[model samples]
Target: MSYNLLTSIDNNRLKQLKNFKTIILNGNNFTSFPSILYQFETLHINENPLCLAPPNDFINDKYISATSNLYVQINDKYEEKLFEIYQQIFIENLTSYDIENLSTRFKLSKTDMNDFREKYSHLKRENKIEILLNIWKQKRGSLANSDALYKFAQLIGDKNLVQKMQKTYLLARKIRI
Candidate 1:
């Protein structure tokens, strides 16, 4: 059977490490190198044995090298990735005006609405109706169309407040432009 090399320390079958081309160690229980690990072409050993250093040959080897020696000094990449994750998390929380401002600020080719939907599918499902209502109200404007006012009334679910807001909107609309 083909094996996935990126096994956690808790995997009982890590004994089969000899069968894989690469191994990613993301655990702390490892006190020393497993003899089976040397068979791998690449090894990603992270956050273990802070005092221990890789030998010069291991550092120079084309097939096997330590991650510590390869420094990724990239501020721009980190910033871009951070922005992507943030957009993924917070897109639904933002208003249309907020999204437009963000698009302008970032010079994005497309709005992050899709990314948001993908990342927060479960949360979106739980709040779908309310979120859509909020978005519709935001798009339709609290003071614009009569249909929008009716929808806003449905959203508020209050007769008195809806009438008051509709009257206020009418009064405001009548004022000099």
Candidate 2:
């Protein structure tokens, strides 16, 4: 195939490779990828420095867009699906098992998984109890426990909190009736 990272190709070679189909460049020497790379059908650029940027030189006639266009589409789909997974776990009030399971399932490094968990923490048992108490205070005519919150309580296995929640719920139901 073609190589560009850590490899210096002279202008003469670059000119000869205009018809070349695939090349992987790392922008190791340059602040941005060379315009010569725009000619390829498939391109891969990895380990780019913070200063390295894509050369905004997509040619309509010669450049086929297999690299940039495909990368954007794939990145977008991956991010969307990832967001959905995070939301699902957060709403479920993620259990210790879910945390371990999701990280393993995604093959994420522990550090990466920790960062993700920090962003999407589930409500603590106390927080759920507080919310339930608030609903009782508001007397909103209905006292339906949110499924995620309840499920999370079940998974958390705090018998005291569960009993407290049960008592609170009966009290709220009595008030409503």
Candidate 3:
């Protein structure tokens, strides 16, 4: 639905043919900055694709400088949407394309979320206890996700994990009551 925000007109080179004094393409997922539009007196594309790369490509300034916030804002927006999608997937028993999409779309193999990345690594290593604990930390407080987590723990034959998750859920329920 949000794709309608940009139409064929937005992506068309004809849009650049206009003798406009200024051009603003912020928040647009433009893969390449067109050379033809460089004649503009003002151009603002900071939050778009070009800013996602290392700052050195554009300028020598460090990320702590003024240029950094634009990229950070994009990442923050992405993370917020990812969280919402995760919750919805849990509720609907849907599979998350998070891992795949992040790789293909965002071009991120790994992120700076250390705790979460470490937990994911633990799952990859099949470190049973640590993986179980990470699942609880990640999904426990939520209703649908917690149920899915319980089932996963069962499927893995970790009775201890299932009991631990049950204990926390029951304790939280008691407190809520």
Window of ten residues with lowest summed lDDT in model 3: 1-10
- List runs of model 2 lying over 4 Å from the truth: 1-9, 26-29, 59-177
Position 85, candidate 2: lDDT: 36
lDDT of 1 by residue, 24-104 (tens): 663342334444454567766544422133344445555333334432212223333333332222333333233334333
Error of 2 at 36 (Å): 1.6
Compared with the true structure, model 1 gives a TM-score of 0.25
lDDT of each residue in 41-145, candidate 3, tens digit only: 676764443224333444353324544665566555544443343333333332232333322332223442444466565453233333333344444343324
Compared with the true structure, what per-residue lDDT tens digits does model 2 show for residues 17-66? 87778877644433345667666776666533322235566534444465
Q: Pull out the clashing pairs in model 2.
A: none
Clashing pairs in 1: none
Q: Between 2 and 3, whose lDDT is larger?
A: 2
**Candidate 3 deviant stretches above 4 angstroms:** 1-21, 31-42, 46-51, 61-64, 94-177
Each model's backbone clash number: 0, 0, 0
TM-score of 2: 0.29
